[model samples]
Target: MQPVQMTPAERAALERLVEHARGDTGQSRRVADFLLAWWNAGQCGSYDLTTAWGVDDTIMDDMCVVFRLASRANSYPETLGCGPQFEAIVRAWRPKLVE
Candidate 1:
């Protein structure tokens, strides 16, 4: 599916809504930024996401939400296509650091 192109204003409004819906905390914001950067870097794959969290899945869902929203805003096809991959990663996420 072709991503709807959002105007700058629309994009900002959606971003604000997402940020607010996700708690709008410092850590949330930082995680959102990190995901955006990672997506922009053309990075993907279950292994990459797993390593990115370092086995601590505390914020996995929230990060996935941020990633989805950012993907829509930027029309990133790869990230958008990875919904199932993201879910799988979240499902298998470990609660503590992997040794």
Candidate 2:
């Protein structure tokens, strides 16, 4: 299926997430990059990539770590709440990233 388009709000939220991710430590940044790449590929509902990357099978908990890292990077109280928005942005940006 074709990816859905993102609204302006979603775009803004993704920018915020990226900004937050930028401040993460090395390991956390690796996790964030993997999440972003996976999300961008329209693969948010599974942990296959995480497992392949040697991430713990408990991906939800791993995502929480990413969220915490992002929060620390950006001082955004709302950072942890950005998962849905990030997913949307990833879907929207997938074609561009792939090309």
- The prediction achieving the highest lDDT against the true structure is 2
Work out the TM-score per prediction: 0.30, 0.29
Going through the candidates in the order shown, the clash numbers are: 0, 0
lDDT of 2 by residue, 4-98 (tens): 34445444545544544445354434445555653432543333444335434454354554544544444332344556655544444343553
User: How well does candidate 2 match the true structure in TM-score terms?
Assistant: 0.29
| lDDT, residue 14, model 1 | 39
Cα lDDT, all candidates: 0.43, 0.46
lDDT for each residue of candidate 1 in 1-99, tens digit (9 for 90 to 100) = 666555555445434533432444544444433543434344322224533453225455545555566656565424335444333322333212222
Quote model 1's TM-score: 0.30
The clash number for model 2 is 0
- lDDT for residue 93 in candidate 1, whole number 0-100: 33
| Stretches > 4 Å off in candidate 2 | 1-3, 25-34, 37-99
Check candidate 2 and list the clashing pairs. none
Native RMSD of candidate 1 (Å): 11.9
